[model samples]
Target: MTTERAYHHGDLRRAILAAALDVIAAEGPTALSLRDLARRAGVSHAAPAHHFKDRAGLLTAIAVEGYGLLAATLQKAESLRDLGLQYVRFAAAHPAHFQVMFRPELLRPDDPELLAARERTRNQLHTAVEGYSDDPAIGVMAAWSMAHGFATLLLSHNLDGLLDGRDPEEAFLSLTNEMFQSAKNPATG
Candidate 1:
């Protein structure tokens, strides 16, 4: 067997979760199970329980990791608009996590790690609008709406089918920019 299949110790949890993501990405959430993940990870069927109490625990872990990854992606962008594009890209790239990340009810908000990751993403998004206008609260809410709407539309294929000739990201950026700019114009107020 390969060294990767050895599974000596120290990171079995991560390895199992990675294997789980691979399965979920390939098949779907319906096909995912701790025993199946443990098999893919080259560990014993009982091994996963040491990390995840059950299937729900595994799903929670996936959601937690997804939130952290989303936060990191948002933080990497130079601006809120760029972050919105990146958010769509990230969702397309990590469909496994993207599938679970948003259903907040699926995760225990009381779980410290999940909450921290969620808050980190929220704060990062809030920071992205720090220079938008004098009212940080309004600016943040507007940016949030744009990003969330764009990401949701992209994921749901709402824009994917409608944006056949144009780049969806560019279209989203252009449309939101114009609308927000128009809204900000005092002449229109």
Candidate 2:
């Protein structure tokens, strides 16, 4: 139950979203619950429902926001390699959003906001590799896969031992540089 003061607060929605992100960061997306978020936010159990409708709705909102953020980050990149590095950095900086954004089953993929946000991200990637490949779509796919795979590996702690005491960002940049070099010169690869 929410205290009267909490119910009257103007930022309940933001509070709920922040709580949800914290929960997802600590326990993964599967553990997220509106009721728990409400408790964490000091709001009524029904408050989250009022804002998001349901679990899928909440996840959809997260996915939409995540895509928008990723698009904005990618837009700042001056090169294709920088774009890939930004992708990995975004995942590391916002693990909860990254997790929810990639799991389509957990979200309402057909939602208008989600679709628009996703297209923005796709466009950013396509523009980044526009001149690098004759088939830009394939280039976008390869770049997305490489960054997504590396981010997933980092998030899952699969690269802890493999990093050899280097910072994850440095290691990721090194790996991307090597990949870009190999793509440029297949004989050297």
Candidate 3:
């Protein structure tokens, strides 16, 4: 009789998540599979399942992690504009996480950890917006829309020609400044 060796890793969960991120980055989230993650992690097929019951659970974990990272990034901003810049920077730096974080359909949104992480990030955004605008809600929405849209455009290559050799961050900052300036003086806009 042949005996299968026990799976032993320093941190199987983190390993699997790292593998999953690589897969998502290279092929989008739809192509991710626990089996493939295990293969990438060099573990047994069932190893990933032990940590995450299914794809939803795995994705939920990723969403939670993404939110935590975003919260940390936003918290470091010195101003509302800096917050927006950080948001775009985070999205660009963590494209895989950014892709998964906003797709509620792909995650178990009711997961407590996911909820907490999301709330933390949202609070960071709201606090920053509140400091800058008379209408906090509208400010929050506009800032999020601008940052998310800019990141999406940059990531999808839609801004390739429009950027015209400018650094993405500099272009985003300039665009943000222009929009805010226009908002301040609608007649000039």
Candidate 4:
């Protein structure tokens, strides 16, 4: 960061968080350092301290951003099946955020913004499964597990053979549709 700075240019917080995502995507979160983030953002090493206090703060920022993005993604998908497919797509597109967003042990969960964002994400998912009133909790939990597991497998390439050369979008939709079939009772619909 330019030591010669004014409020107009330093927007250090956004810069640091963007750089952290870039570094995490390329090298994983464990490789993240406040200094490395500063270097990546072309800021002086001390600049990040003004925004993130420490590495944990940086992580909390990442998690908060991840939750906000997740909430947006799930909100956009009009159906539970679509939301599940989008979850897989999100994991593929934003692996860095996806990697640590759900791992509660990695960051301080009590951070108010993080908690609020996370709750928003959960509510988005809950709304997606709203049609399954017959067994809402079980259906929501099962749907959540299926989507999370399939996305994890698909993004990780563990399901490479199962994909059987299908286009990724079609494959994601197919898997989610199949999962939806199992999660909700057909007689009710």
TM-score of 4: 0.84
Assess every candidate by TM-score. Answer: 0.80, 0.92, 0.92, 0.84
How high is the lDDT of residue 115 in model 1? 77
The reply for model 2, stretches above 4 Å from the true place, is 1-7
Q: Which pairs clash in model 1? A: none
lDDT of 1 by residue, 113-181 (tens): 877888888888778778877999888777777767777777667886678878777887787788867
Winner on lDDT (1 vs 3): 3
Off by over 4 Å in 4: 1-8, 180-189
Candidate 4 pairs with clashing backbones: 1-43, 1-44
Better of 1 and 2 by lDDT: 2
TM-score of 1: 0.80
lDDT of 3: 0.87
* Candidate 2 lDDT tens digits, 51-160: 89999999898888899889888888888888888998899999999999989999997899999999888888888889988999898889889889999999999999
Q: Clashes per prediction?
A: 0, 0, 0, 2
lDDT of each: 0.77, 0.87, 0.87, 0.79
lDDT score, residue 185, model 3? 85
Q: Tell me the tens digit of each residue's lDDT in model 4 across 51-170.
A: 888888888888989888888777778777788877877777788889779778778879999989988988887777887656778877877887788777876778899878888778
Per residue, candidate 3 scores C-alpha lDDT tens digits across 1-189 of 111222353477887788889989999999999988877777778878888899999989998999988988888899888888999999999999999999989999789999999888888889888767789989889999999999999998999999999999999999989998888889843
Q: How close is candidate 2 to the true structure, as a TM-score?
A: 0.92
Off by over 4 Å in 3: 1-7
Alpha carbon deviation, residue 42, candidate 3 (Å):
2.4
